[model samples]
Target: MMENRNLFLAILLSIGVLGLWEYFYGAPQREKAQQIAEQQRIERGVDQNAAQGAAPGAQVPSNPAGAPTAPAVVANPGVTREQAIAETKRIPIDTPRLKGSIDLTGGRIDDIALKDYRETVEPNSPNIVLLTPPGGPQPFYAEYGWVGAAGTTAPLPGANTVWTQEGSGALTASTPITLSWNNGQGLTFKRTISVDVNYMFTVADRVENAGSAAVTLHPYALVSRHGRPHVSGYYILHEGLLGWLGDDGLQEIKYSTIEEEKSISHRAKEGWLGITDKYWATALVPPRGEEFTGRFSAVTNQVPIYQTDYLLNAREVAPGGSTEVKGELFAGAKEVRVINEYQNNLGIPRFELMIDWGWFYFLTKPMFWLIDFFFHLVGNFGVAILIVTVLVKLVFFPLANKSYESMSKMKKIQPELTAMRDRFKDDKVAQQKAMMDLYKKEKINPAAGCLPILIQIPVFFSLYKVIFITIEMRHAPFFGWIRDLSAPDPTTIFNLFGLIPYDPASLPVIGPFLMLGVWPLIMGVTMFLQMRLNPLPPDPTQAMLFTWMPVFFTFLLASFPAGLVIYWSWNNTLSILQQAAIMKRQGVKVELWDNIRGLFRRKPRTQE
Candidate 1:
């Protein structure tokens, strides 16, 4: 009983330390982080009122004045996205990863949807819409054109201008589409649009001077998203305008900040700029090595409009001589591998930065690579997670072996420790001195047991961040009721594991508290069994604290991602097996079964 009390006290002290650390440090750190985030939002001018009133799928109307204005307030003539698409004569865009059309009216690359990804995990859910036509309910699209020099008599393509398709039939990866528009003043503008198997669209714009004189014009491309879209509001994720300007590194501007600042401008030798969502992004990559000015702006009228645009230096088109400008539009999923490929092969600078790897990039990226490697080997992400947990344990085995050995030694010396306490009951200083002497004599470090746990905290957080932010984990599934590993475990205990027809999550106040799922319960049980590997505390207070730790953790982790919970449970089980083996090698008796039986056994009553 005395040995049990010492072990229980040690565990209880560890729990108390962790609890106090979280309360005094972790809580305030989180609050400070939130405050910092709030300050950043304020600095960027995130206006709640403007965001609420912003119309979706709206675009800036063509300015007849030929002067650049805020794209948000420019009223699109179409009322609905479908109506806008129907109103225009378009060329169909069909590819393995994309399905949409090229609106011939202004030769805009709009009406795009990601063919491979859906809105929900359901098989029949609609594909995610990425780009929409102008004049639609949500006006988000990309357009390329030439800006004539001031006082030039050439007419450039505006929103109302209709361009005729040079060729017939649908545009495929093999066949490119060409659009031609001729101004009566003797300038012919031809745009050839081509797409690859993935999400890249190559646009080559050529201008011919049929007139007797030369004209100077600037080639420009703009991706405008009218109205503020919904954001996940997670601090770890960035949903806004992002780009790599030459030598400027990366620039990110939130929608609200655009509204507050009106516009952000930068001059780069060459680069790409665009608006990004949590999963998808649309960016305009100008010709490399060319000098251009990039701008991100927000305009408010009926709705807020966000636009990312770049204008190249003015070029002279001599009589009968044509000048061409080549650009690429990336409108698709933020797939890390695909983006990295583009960055390497196409020379798109810092393209992989689009995916938020967070501050722990060093750990998060390698962890993802390991998990991804195991996923391919196992053919299931759930199994991959389990395999990765075992691999992590193996890597830390050396350190953990020493820690567990120390714990075993401490457990064996618990009786001596308790006797020392009794021998010095009236002198606390003597008791501590005797305990230290015994510890040094036995070569035991009481703090060694916490080393493994201390190392695991960061690894655990990094894994959570990776699972939460990566697109591969978006709809990943495990066995049974775990369909989306990134999402919280679906099966809750309150409804008797789905035996009842009610959801506890719907109840007010208690809904979240009652959301304990199967995975969490399994995790709690593993933790409890792992703790029981050592002797229990003799003191009732310490024993009760140790007993309740697992329950507390089970409820706390119920809302975490299913994959994370699975990893925790598996890690706990592995630790239990490891400690048991160590304790046996140290000639210490395992007391787990004894402790389990102790719970059911009644204590004898003492005569008063």
Candidate 2:
């Protein structure tokens, strides 16, 4: 009982420390930083809706400092996406998992929509819009072009340069499209774009110089997002500009950070850089083993834009000479297995790092694969999670058996322990020594009960990270009323489990506190039953703490993902059953029913 009390106290202390730290330190710091950033943005005249008014066919204007610039022609207000697509000539993009168009002007691969995903879980919902063309309500696009040298007279492709399609068929995995432009100064440029069945687009740019003098130019690719997009503002997940620079590892910069710093530069021999949202990402991969400069910048203007760009070394084309550069763009969901395949087959460095797997990558990634394997076999993620929990329990069955057996022995010797404690009430050191002797004689480990719990801490945290960060868990359904595994359970007791007609989540202060869902209730019940496996603590304070722990945990886990809560409830039930069986086999009477009866039984009146 003392050991149990100590463990409970330790757990409570840790929780209190974390709660106080988050409320007193972390939340205030984040709020203050956000306020300062908002003030800075206002001082810079940053218009949040400036990107909505960008003109179609507007290329990133080159600034003297080499930062991205707003459109030369001001965008007309109230222009819709349909209007923007209609304003420019485009080549249709058809793929198994994507649908959109490639803008002919400036040869940008913009206007992309994810076919496999939707904006909502409802059937027939609109497909998720990943990228939109310039001048659209939200301008997010990827553009590849060349920059002319300081003294070169060659007219490189700019915002207004329109390319003529050299082919007749639409751009598909099997059919690539080639666009050509002639500067009329004896310089001919051709861009051939090819997309795979997935989201990768390969761009091959060739330059033929027929002029009398040699020309020097630099090829560059950029993934630019005009205006800041909506973010979940979660500290655990990163949603902004990020990239994998070879040997430099991963570089993640928030939009606000970019705005404050103006720009960030990284030199790499070969790498990929891009802008990342919570679910989708757009990255540009330069040619392998090629020296390049990557920059993440926020260009402040009428329509401020955040850009992830890279410029390769200059290539000189002499008279009647030609040069070609090959690069690739990844625009789609950040699927773990798909990214890993690209990293292995295509030699893309650290592509899997795109997902925020957190600090426990070793445990989190393997746990994801284990769950994924079962998901394939079971055909449902919810069922797979249950099976995974069972497997984990089975794996630690031996250790848990030992712990439970020790606990049963301790319970059987409760009378002897109490008597010893009374005899040594005035001698604390002697009591501990005698207790240790008794433990040795009984061949019992008083601390054994904590082993299983300690082992579960990392596994629990890793599973949470996997479920929260992986795209596969998005919109995944369990049985019913749980459409999205990444979200908390929808049904709350405050509305009588949806039998009533009110939303407690909308209330202030106490709203989130009242969100005790069905699964959390089930979990709390299981936890309470598990605690009943041992006799109730003798001390009044200890008994009260033990009784309230389950209720505390239930409310604490109410806001977690439904899938996680389900796992916890299932795991606790299994533990209770296993402990009961073990206690019976050890020839010890289980005190669970007696404890429950004691809870409701009327106490005999004292002779006052």
TM-score of 1: 0.86
Model 1 residue 587 lDDT score: 98
Score every model by TM-score. 0.86, 0.91
lDDT of 2 at 192: 94
Question: Against the true structure, whose lDDT is highest?
Answer: 2
lDDT tens digits, residue span 1-608, model 2: 44564557547654873584466335754665675576456424433354554233334445443433434433334678889999998999988998999889888888999999998888799999998887666688888888876776667887668999995878888999999999999899999999888888999999999989899988888888876766656666788999989778789898879978887888899789999987889999999999988888886554457888888888999999999999999999999888898889899988888898877799999889999999999888989999999999989999999988998887777778888888999998998899889999999999887776776777787888788889899999999898988888889998999999999989976787788999999999998898777655666666666677888888878877898898889999999899899989989887787777665545411111
lDDT of each: 0.80, 0.81
